[model samples]
Target: MNTTPLRLLIHGASGRMGQALQRLGSEADSGCDVVAAVSRKVDARVLEGIPQFAASELHGVPEFDVAIDFSLPQAFDAILGLCVARRVALVSGTTGLSDAQKAALDAASVLIPLSWASNFSLGVAVLHTLVERAAQALPGWDCDIVEAHHTRKLDAPSGTALTLGEAAQAGGAAPHYASLRAGDIVGEHLVQFTGMGERIELVHRASNRDIFARGALHAARRLHGRAPGRYRVADLL
Candidate 1:
């Protein structure tokens, strides 16, 4: 195993996942360094010692090996452009991106090593695989997906839910989706396959945001030396 620590950059550093990454990535055993943090406004009190810069200040910031973005979609283009320009690997978990933004990400992936996932939780990735297999086994079953997140979560049918639905579709099932936004729920997803008299439900619940933060860091480590392309959590799994 390589003992050298990876130099890391955290985008949207004031956000929940960004703060989680900062806390975890600061551990001595984490095998990475948080070199800089980017946000719309640099909050010195929240992000002390570590260099904090506004998004507009990114061009003046020095390069880091990899960048983990948990920012909003509106900040994505700037982050993507900066990463590509600096040839930095990117690990992003931002959701609810516009189609044009996604296309741009695809285009940028050709130039920098980029790994983006809706949910970075390892269990969620496993849930996706299981959902796929279950969908394949239960032919002609009605598939419905339900996902719940905190009320502040901007996207309906959380990106992970959409990814789960896609997995079901890939396994020859057409799935309908429903989304719920309630108070402070970390995250929860259920994929149900209903047949004649029985039903199968595969569920994943996240009680904390740290799972995603850890997973994104793991992805950044894996992406460090990777070639330019779009990568997924499944690849890490």
Candidate 2:
């Protein structure tokens, strides 16, 4: 295994995902080090001895080897420009990107390795795989995806649900989707498969956001030496 530690920059150091990443960074493989954190407002201490930069401060900083973005949609373009300028690999978990923003990412991927996923939990990845297989095996199966997130979430039909739906389609099934944003539910995805005489359901749940943080870190490590391209969690797995 490679011994050199990967230096990292986190783009959303003030948000929930950011805090989780910060905590996970502290306990990550010895081969990983979160070198800097960039955000609009951050506790100087969260840097854990590394520098903390304002969002505008990114341009002045030196390049990092990799970065994870869980920032808002508005942060995407600037972050993409910075990452591309630095030729750094990126693992982005940001959602609600416009089509243009997504196009920009696709263009940027031609220059540097980038992995983007709506949901990073390993369980979600496995669930997607299972959904894909089930869809293929039961082309006639009727499928529906139901997901619930925190009430504060803005987007309906959470990105994870859409990803799961796409996976189901890729596996040869059509999927209807639903979303419920209530209470403090971290995340729960249920894919129901209905056939001639029976119904099969696959469920994956997350009680906290740390699972995503951990998965993002894992993806960052795997993406370091990859060729420039767009990738997903399944690719990393």
Candidate 3:
């Protein structure tokens, strides 16, 4: 690692993950100093000490070595354009991206290293790995995924659950996704593998959103010295 602390710019500074990142950045040993925070309409108190900006104000701003974004899907393209143009590394945790958005990221990677994942929780990545292994191990076993998120979340199946399902389907038959939304449930995923005599269940639960923020921090550290490319939480872990 470099001797000096990395300067970081945070996007989506008003969202849940962004708030957790703010707390994480304030703590000791975070390895990055938050120099700037961007949000569409952030509460002034939320960014009380940090320099803040509107999304449109990014142009010609002093560049940071890394930019971590938990912004929504709608803002992804703009963020990517800004990061790549600035030659800054990126860690985006936004979900619900369309196929075209992914292709855009792929194009952006040619200019700077960029890591993107639906969920940044390390546990979720482990769950995905386990699901992939189980799906491969039990060929004939039936597969189903049940996922729960906060009621306010608009996307179905949650990105983590879909990631798990995709991993579960890797090198095997297709798996199905079942989504559930209720009051402020942080997250939950259960992947069941069924056979004639027995069933195996893989479960991952999140008590709070901080896990993802921490994971994103870890990813930022891991991705710091790499070349231009995309990465996932598993790669960082």
Candidate 4:
């Protein structure tokens, strides 16, 4: 394992998640050095000790091992292009991407390593594995995913829930979804597999969004020096 800290470029640096990642990346034990930050707009050329660049100025940023993106869909393509152009890895958690944008990721993965996920909590990654296994074992089971999040979250059957549904579908189980938005819940997902006289429920809950940033940082460290390919959050573990 490389003991040297991995060099990271934070995309969407002005957002809450971006701020959290910068904070953690600044820690002595984070195993990461945030060499640069990129956002859709730039105010200060530098902030909190890291160099900053606007989306339009992406090509001007210093080289980095991996780019961790937590921005909106509008800012996704530029950073992805920057990483591919630089031949580096990329980790993104931006949701609500268009089909063409996702297809672009598939095409780009052939040249550089990349992992895009709806949720980056390590626990959620593990739940993906467990849900797939349960779906496989319970051959004829009915799969249902129930997810709840803060009322401010607009999308029903969030990106995470849909991703989990995809996992279940991959295991030969048809999946359904139920979404609830209430209070200030951080995030919750329950994948249930029901068979004759029994049921299995795989669950993961997030109390804070920091887990996503931490997981992306972990992924950045793991993706360094790997062959070009598309990877999942579970793959790093």
- Top candidate on lDDT is 1
- Of the two candidates 1 and 2, the one with more favorable TM-score, higher being better, is 1
TM-score of candidate 4 to 2 decimals: 0.89
Candidate 3 lDDT by residue in tens digits, 1-237? 366777778888888888789789766688878888888864562354678877777664466888899988988787889888878899998889999998999999888998999888877877777888888889988998888888888888788778877897784947788998899998888998889999998888899888889888888878887898887778887
The lDDT of each candidate is: 0.90, 0.87, 0.83, 0.89
Candidate 2's C-alpha runs over 4 A off are 28-30, 43-47
lDDT of 4 by residue, 1-237 (tens): 458888899998988789999999989999888999888888898888988888888899987899999888888988889888999999998888889999999999999999999998888888888888888888988999999998877678899999999889889899999999999898999998888898888889898988888888888888888999999888985
Superposition-based RMSD of candidate 3 using all C-alpha atoms, in angstroms: 1.7
Output the number of the TM-score-best candidate: 1
Greater-TM-score candidate between 2 and 3: 3
Model 1 bad stretches (over 4 Å): none
Give lDDT tens digits, candidate 2, residues 1-237: 668778888898888898788778867453677788889865564356667888978787556899899999988888899889889899999998899998999999999999988999888888988999999998888999999999988887888899889999999898998889899999999999998899999999899898899889889989998999998898886
Clashes of 4: 0
**Total backbone collisions for each predicted model:** 0, 0, 0, 0
Report the lDDT tens digits of candidate 1 across residue range 1-237.
779889998998988998899889888999998988888986572355578888889888766999999999999888899899999899999999999999998999999999989999999999988999998999999999999999989998899999999999999999999999999999999999999999998999999999999999999998899889998898975
TM-score of every candidate relative to the true structure: 0.96, 0.91, 0.94, 0.89
